[model samples]
Target: MGKTTRYRFREYHVTAVADPMALPIFEAVCVTGEERNCAAASGELHAPEELTRWIAGHCAQTGHQSYEQTTRTIVRAEPGAWQ
Candidate 1:
């Protein structure tokens, strides 16, 4: 089993997933309007607040403003035996 935290910025879709397969175990700030979006990873799991801060930095890097988290979903990107 795994947990995924998805957040919506003004022009970004940030998601941090607790999956071993993910580099550093998390990914963040996928720019919504670009065909070649840059995704960043973290070495460890972060709280939603931390992830939001990361998202803000990512947005600020591009001179964009990030709003609040629009949604949070616990998705099972991988299949396995779990209760």
Candidate 2:
């Protein structure tokens, strides 16, 4: 008979981190009309103001009031205490 084998698994917790070296990225898309349109905008992760400014400019130029914003952030997973 084969020897009995066992394995252990550990739980992990994921959290977002803003590292200067690997700054998160912010992406915004204009969705004002019936169909998705306009060029996508992207900027630094920590600075949302820049994205907002771009959105405002796009809205003003294209008379668009609606927009979809996507934030891409870095995350780290750490093992949690064994339960």
Candidate 3:
């Protein structure tokens, strides 16, 4: 008979790390009406303050009063020591 074989598996921990090379993107969309959605507004990698200002402006101009915000962030995951 052939010799018995053995295998081992290692466990790893995962966490999110920010990418220094890329900035987070911020977007906002007006959700004031039920029938249609307004064109999305983006900060294009700008800070949250900038996006908030844009949303406020949009709300004032269109009387939207309601909006949905989205933030896209670039992250990296590194494997930790085997456990």
Q: Is candidate 2 or candidate 3 better by lDDT?
A: 3
Residue pairs whose backbone atoms clash in candidate 2? none
Model 2: lowest-lDDT 10 consecutive positions: 36-45
Please state the error at residue 7 of candidate 1 in Å.
Answer: 46
lDDT of 1 by residue, 1-83 (tens): 69999996554334445555433323354544455534443224435667666777767776544233333335444444433
RMSD of 2: 3.7
For each of the candidates, give the backbone clash count.
Answer: 0, 0, 0
Every model's TM-score: 0.35, 0.65, 0.74
Please state every model's RMSD to the true fold in angstroms: 17.6, 3.7, 3.3
> Among these predicted structures, which one has the highest lDDT?
3
Candidates ranked by lDDT, best first? Answer: 3, 2, 1
Against the true structure, candidate 2 reaches a TM-score of 0.65
lDDT of 1 at 70: 33
lDDT of 3 at 46: 60
